[model samples]
Target: MSLGLRTLWGWTRRLFPWVLAAIVLGLVARQARMVEWAEVWVAVQSLAVSQLALAAALAALSYALYASFDLVGRHLTRARVSVGRSLGTAAISYAFNLNFGSLVGGLAMRLRLYTRWGLSAPTVGKIIAYSMVTNWLGYLWIAGAVLIWAPPRLSQEWLPGALVLRGAGVALVLAAAAYVVLCFVSRRRQLSLRGHSMELPSGPLALLQATLGGASWLLIAAIVWTLFAGRVDYPDVLGALLLAAVAGVLTHVPAGLGVLEAVFAASLASDRLPVTEVLAVVLVYRATYYLMPLVLALPAYGWSEVAARRRSARAQAVGDAPV
Candidate 1:
């Protein structure tokens, strides 16, 4: 990379969070005007306390599963951190990643925290890469299954035909399966793609990644399904959520704000679920699944960052003392 290009890339990295925030704010403002607040409120209120509690519990479990991915990272890097400590850090970073964008949340925060905790930059990078794979393995399988057998009621504008959807589904399933199969059969410890190579986790480790990943996706869909009060098919809800997730990532919208709503409305709305009800349910899901955790994560994340920096500084000072 040229010096000017490198400088430009650095500036873009630093400024990306702000850009994402601006986009989110603009999208929120536009969507806020179009939303039917009264209907959303009614839908929100229709949920009984017991149902809400159930949804919250599901959300908690889902978050726990995601946090456990930190263990995979720990194992991959052979980091000396304890399970409890790793889980705590992962929980905080995961919350930030969900609300903020991945740049500031998962990638940056994990890099910052793990390196402070004593891992090198390359180790942290590997951890992040492995966690990402573990995170998405299940989504691919779920997407494939749903697309092939139980795709949502998307309009022609959203999805053209079952054949195309099924083809895509097969591709997804094969891609996920191929990873597992290769990991199982390959005697080599590294996987190469293009000119880049990744150190492959052991076959059992790969299997664990698939299982935990699949469970995480299932738990997420279950939370949304619970919020939907079982009114919609579970597969349809999963499919729509998978679609929203993909859209959110592609659009680079923070937490897929507005994208999820648009995708869900397009995929789920029907005689059974009017557009308003669909919007309302998604709003509640966002609150329960996204906003609530972010509320709790911010303080801890800030405190940990400060504490980690201070600890590192003290250690550095001690090392540099007259000897």
Candidate 2:
């Protein structure tokens, strides 16, 4: 890309979060003239406390599962970071990644934690790459399966025909499978693209990453479904979550502020499940999965930093005592 085009693209990504929020607010304002805000608030209030608790439990499990992504990365990089520390760092960064933006959580947070643990910048980058691939690969696998076998019924025909969707699903599976195959056969697991060297894990490790990704996505979908109280089928809920996931990434909205509500309200709401209720469910889901984890991560991050400093101090003392 040329300089001008690249600058415009950067600006677009940076600004889209605010733009998306504005658009969402504008739409809500327009709808407020027609829909009763009181009804929406009532629906939100109607959600059971038990349902919210269940969502919170599921969110905890999902967070635990995702921390393994960094473990896989540590394995790939052969970093000396301990298992407990790696998992804690991953959990903390992943939480921030959801509540904040990738710039803060994924890159900066991961870098800060791992570097404090004494890993080089390149080693940290490898770990981050491993975790990101694990995330997206699994998403492609599960999303492809869902789209092929049990695509959600959208209220709007904004996308192309069902046949095209199925075709896209097939492509997704093929692409994911191709990745595994290449990891199996390629002698040199590293790839150099645009001055960046990406190292792929072994084929078996790649498959493990995919499994972690698929399970994490499934848990997240389940959390959302639990909040919704089965207003839609599980498949439909999963599809809506996937659609919102894409929108969240594209918009780069912090904590997906309005993205989840807008997407779910538009995509999942039907004659049976009203838009207001869908919005309500999303609000609770965000509270459970996004906000709660972020709050917990603050303490976890502080402890990790403290532990890293102590470990470093001990190592320095031992080195100085040697004769």
Candidate 3:
């Protein structure tokens, strides 16, 4: 790459997250204008304490499962960090990611934390790559199964035809299967792309990744289902959530703020469940699952960062001191 182009690219990478955040904030503001805050508050207030507790518990479990993503990634990358540290990094990074979206929230946070823990840039990169792959592997598995078995009614409108949805499901499953096959067949377990060499985890590790990733999605779906309180069946809600999640991710908006709501409101709303109720449920889910964790994570992450910097400074000073 030319110097001018490389510098431009560097600046773009640094600035992209902020730009994305601004755009998402604008979109969220627009969506907020459409919502009835009073009604949403009433719906939230009306929720049973037991149900709210259940949802909170499920959300906790879902996040714990999310932490496992990093655990698996650490193993795959052979990072020497302790399990507790891995879990903390995963939880805090995901908490940020859930609110700030992927690029700035998750990846940036992980890069900072893992690097501070003595991991090289390449190792951290591998961990991030593995975790991302693990997440999507599970998403494809569940989404494929749900689409094939109890295809959401909304698919007919979003997709070209019923058969297309089925075909897509089959393709997704086959793609996942192919990854497993590659793990088994390729002894070297590596891929080379554009001068970069990437190593794939062993078959057993890959299988574990798929399992953990898939379980995380299942638990998350359960959380959503619990929030809905049987208003809709599990399969339908899971399918809708998967679709909405994909849409939200594609938008590159922070936490998929407005994009997620729009997709869920469109896909999950029906005669039996009004759009208002769906929106209310979504609001509660976002607050509990996304915002709450972020509220806790920021301070904890800040402390860790400060501590790491202090340790670094002390080490440098000690090295410079005359004996």
**lDDT winner:** 2
Candidate 1, residues 204-230, lDDT tens digits: the string is 888889999989988898988988888
Best by TM-score: 3
Q: Which runs of model 2 end up more than 4 angstroms from their true locations? A: 1-35, 155-157, 305-323
What are the runs in model 3 whose C-alpha is more than 4 Å off? 1-37, 155-157
Worst 10 residues of 2 by lDDT: 152-161
Candidate 1 overall lDDT versus native: 0.83
Model 3 residue-pair collision total: 0
CA lDDT of each prediction against the hidden true structure: 0.83, 0.84, 0.81
Tens digits of per-residue lDDT, candidate 2, 1-323, equal 99999999999998988876565556535544655557778988999999988988999999999998999889878999999989988989999999888989999999998898789999999899889899999999898998899876653333556787788889988888989888999999897878998887898988888889999999999999888887688888898788778767766668767767766776787788888788778888888888888889999888877987899899899999959
Q: For model 2, which pairs clash? A: none
Which pairs of residues collide in model 3? none
Between candidates 1 and 3, which one is better according to TM-score?
Answer: 3
Clashing pairs in 1: none
